[model samples]
Target: MNLEARKIEFVQEFLKLQSEEAISRLEKILRNEKKMSENRLVEPMTQDELNNRIDQLESDFQNNRFKSSAELLAKYE
Candidate 1:
């Protein structure tokens, strides 16, 4: 069958699932699959885009928009 048909078939079969353990396992698998798909959808920036991002970060740093690593760690301790 085609993708949509298979998806509908999966939905029909999934609706027939009754065991709590089976459903919980399926839920975990679906969450991991979604995270993986989202990561795959992210496109890498070009060289000019990367340079602009670095320039913005440098400006933010110079304007005191960042914190030191030691200061950040001290808050948790």
Candidate 2:
């Protein structure tokens, strides 16, 4: 069977079980699946990267290399 068909069959079988123990097992399986999915996730940029970006922004601002919000909007109109 295809993935979607297998999923539907699994859900149908899960519904048919209808016992507290079965439900608990399904919940544990879902939780583990979620954790496994999350395990493959990547972390955001490090604090050092963020600090460097902020420092670059501050340097640009000090040198008037950045435009004010009003000046940016004026370009659009």
TM-score, one value per model: 0.60, 0.53
What is the C-alpha lDDT profile of model 2 across 1-77, one tens digit per residue? Answer: 89999999998998899699989988999999999989879578899999999999999999989888999999999
In model 1, how many backbone clashes occur? 0
lDDT, candidate 1, 26-72, per-residue tens: 99999999999999999999999999999999999999999899999
CA lDDT of every candidate = 0.97, 0.92
lDDT at 34, model 2? 97
Q: Report the lDDT of model 2 for residue 67.
A: 87
Judge candidate 2 at residue 27 and give its lDDT: 98
